[model samples]
Target: MFIEERKFEYWMNRLVSHFETVNRKIDKLSNTENKINDEVLLDNQDLCLLLKVSKRTLQRFRSSGKLPYKRIGKKTYYLESDVHEFIQNGFSKK
Candidate 1:
């Protein structure tokens, strides 16, 4: 069975578009060998490890609004952008 030219082109175009989107996402995830950027989602433990602090310190940061995070169920997540902003703004003890 022969496919119509227009139908073949449409399917090919859609496949190409889907591949392009997936390729873009892959590049975004693995763009750097060593550095993951602001698009990454980080949990509390990752934040504490990155900042070299205890889990309690992270809890205090969240409680005092020194950092911003999202809570889904019992787990929390912070965007790398927010953590970067918090660092750039200089978090200090009162």
Candidate 2:
């Protein structure tokens, strides 16, 4: 069988370039998201969706001091950093 060396090299370079572009975009978004997390407050609905947990669980966390939150008027909000910290602290080596 004959190998098309030039075609192989071209496709491989293209794939690597695509991956690099995707990685750079992801890194940028990650940094921006982290910055937004600490400064922004998330309402109960947003928090629930992000964590994929029910509202009752969130209430329990607040009551138990697992997650810190705030109240402005009748609405409750949580900082993104607090949620991130909560998840990180929960990691266990198994």
Candidate 3:
């Protein structure tokens, strides 16, 4: 198909513009993911290692309401801030 030069140039520019918009959106999403990761959600294993306790001991903390956690599906996650506060509040393994 014979296309006019002006129409071809316009189409190319539009395609480039659309790609740029998509790239910007991807970058924004990547930045959001990085921020979320920076917030640092700790799972059971991470907490156990940091606290130097066994999984059963950590479970005790959860059951006793000494540590705050969020359970998603079958996995538990603790916010970094909450863990810091727990330690600051003099949490001890009994």
Candidate 4:
């Protein structure tokens, strides 16, 4: 069936408007994700790699209370800020 020019233009405009709204929502969600990533938690391996240390050394820090960590079940996680502070305060094995 043949369609009128006006109706076709109207449909195209509506489709474009819908896509614009969807794009804006996607952009907003990405920005929120970036903000969350700023406070990202680091697991044992990530912390070790960042500090260039071994798992045994990390255990020593935790045991001596030199580094702060959160344990959930059998896994341990450290906050990025805490690691930065630990570095700033001069991490040394006693």
lDDT of 2 at 81: 78
Model 1 has an lDDT value of 0.84
Give the CA lDDT, 0 to 100, for residue 34 in model 3: 16
lDDT of 3: 0.85
The superposed Cα distance between candidate 2 and the true structure at residue 20, in angstroms, equals: 38
TM-score of each: 0.56, 0.55, 0.57, 0.57
lDDT string, candidate 4, 1-76, tens digits:
9999999999999999999999999998876521124676778898889889999999999999999988867988
Candidate 2, residues 26-93, lDDT tens digits: the string is 99887663123348788889888988889998898888888898887898888877878977877121
Distance from true location, Cα of 42 in model 1, Å: 0.5
Which runs in model 2 stand beyond 4 Å of their true positions?
1-38, 91-94
lDDT of 3 by residue, 7-67 (tens): 9999999999999999999998866521135787888888889999898987888899989
The runs of at least 3 residues in candidate 1 whose Cα sits more than 4 Å from the true structure, single-residue gaps closed, are: 1-38
TM-score of 4: 0.57
The residue-level lDDT of candidate 3 at 57 comes to 82
Candidate 1, 49-92: lDDT as tens digits: 89998989888999999999888579888887889999988866
